[model samples]
Target: MNQDALSRELALRIGLAARALPDTDAKRLLAVLADCTGMPMTESQLANIDLATLKAAGQGEFAKVADDVLQQALDILKNTASEKILPAVQPYEEGEMPNSVRIACASDDAIHVNGHFGGCTWFMVYQVNSEEARLIDIRATDIPAGLVVDDKNIYRAEQIQDCKVVYVASVGGPAAAKIVKLGIHPMRLEAVASLADIISQLQQVMAGSPPPWLAKAMGIEVSERFKFDREAVG
Candidate 1:
């Protein structure tokens, strides 16, 4: 079922539901819903969908997904609208932090790094140096109509092209490769964690001696990057 055929409210619900599941989008979800609930799914019919029907429609697609995640998706489908709590973005300016690296974090909620790279609702960007980190911006991943899944990844990568590193709860191999090709390093933390904790750890690493790859990302010269390790050895 194409989004155009559905009411604006139903379309939003489907989009939210799709984002709740890993590596899924509205178009794909609509196909699954059509196959399971019968074609030409209507607003009232979708609102009545149950978890069992959703699971049957998944056909093992949700096998690895947590029960809570599925429940969240179901909630989106059942409700007309759900409130989204997001962290407030701090003020920032270009050249605010010299020698800092910009990081992109895939997140559904603003407070946690709990999103899959391909289907995440938001990318919370931060500018970080050894001393501090600041939330710079939040970019939404809104897929345009008729775009395929592969193109979705490309579009997401482009959204954070200026970031030096990207952190996600999960990322597919193909999506990881695409981010890498764009000069963005992709890091995974499959379990949900507070974004503050993750950023704290990153600051600790930077304050001491960052790994070579991280150093490179901060624009440090390759030859000078190992000085900390060498000094400790000596």
Candidate 2:
């Protein structure tokens, strides 16, 4: 049979077996089937399969699909569930912890930044906070050097859900333009400097009112931080 036909047949059989079992059992069975077939089993397919067909095939016939392996996986899932060993959820803490901005610096020689922990030739990300500035995280990238800085090859914006501010830096041109189009501010800063000093300078600049051209380039606008009171999943 063709691959599609085989998949359809297997899906039909698995779905029938699943429907006859309890919710938990069905889920376990489906997981095993999915693993064996290397494909996910959808509820619609299960519903479409005729249970009578599966019954006619009988246990002996079903065993051809390695019923032992499926049963073993189901047993493991059952034991795990019965143990009640689930991840914990942590509630969101109250109060504004302060907002921080990231700065990515690159040069014409070779784009390099300080590693967060401690490593040369690494990407350094500086975070600007209201009270003080600090380094949050840094990573390593393979971007070559001597590339002219432009909207296409440098400076980008990162948008994260529930994040109040847009993250710019450690990116290239097209991505940066996309961020600006989304109404997110983008700032470009280079050279190694103390994180605190950078934040202080940024605050000073904003206090004086940004120049029209600079403000327009950065896509500056009023933004408020958002807080969610939810438990953290453990």
Candidate 3:
């Protein structure tokens, strides 16, 4: 299908739906759309789509794609007003709060670690220490119109270079390695979770004795971590 055949609104909807699915691009999604709703895709056909029809259409190429992901994509196709509400960022400055490490979360809803590292729409950054955690920034993953990125994973990693840790619902091994090489620890969650809950758990670990890796991320030497306890006993 010629890209020029799609109206601007239809094109935008297709683009958004494709982005919602992991490892899928506009061209691939267009093929699937053709199979589901016929060629010369239109807003009227998309608006009438059901999850059952989408699943049947996707069984060949998108069989491995999760139902939730398919549903999200379908939702975008159905609703022109499908904008996700982003959380507000609080004020923060470098070195303003000592002993805190910046953490990045791959999230689409701004409330949960629900996005794959490579495909997430936003990186919700938080400033966290042993005592508290606060949302500091929200970084969009959309590349600028003219800027070309050769390696998307590397570009994503560069976006959070200042962060000490990154949490995601999923990430490829190669992408994880790239993030690790940049001195940022990549943590893949087994299940979707609230960002606030994850931060609370991190704070708990920090309040006690952190493991060697966590210690390093927090810039605390393992040897010096228990010095205060030893001194009080002496």
Which structure among the candidates has the greatest lDDT? 3
Tens digit of lDDT per residue, candidate 1, span 1-234? Answer: 112312454567779889988999998888878766676665445655766777777575565667788889877765523676444567889888877999999987555688999988899999999877877788999976776666879899999999999999999999899999999999998567667668878989987778888888777775687876788999
* Sliding window of 10 residues with minimal summed lDDT for model 3: 1-10
lDDT of 3 at 68: 88
Per residue, candidate 3 scores C-alpha lDDT tens digits across 25-106 of 9899888888887876654466567777776675567777899898888777654235754445668877776677899999
**Which model, 1 or 3, shows the larger lDDT?**
3
Across residues 1-234, which tens digit of lDDT does each residue of candidate 2 receive?
022332444444445445444452455555544443334543223323332333223332334444444343333322211222111122233232243333443211111221211112333344443443333333333334885545422232231212223323244466556655655444444543322334456656544554544333334442211111122321
Q: What is the C-alpha lDDT of each candidate?
A: 0.78, 0.36, 0.79
Specify the highest-TM-score model's number. 3
- 225 in model 1: Cα distance from truth in Å? 4.0
Q: In angstroms, give how far residue 191 of model 3 lies from its true place.
A: 0.6
TM-score of 1: 0.61
What is the lDDT, from 0 to 100, of the residue 28 in candidate 2? Answer: 53
Each candidate structure's TM-score, on Cα atoms with residue i matched to residue i, is: 0.61, 0.28, 0.62
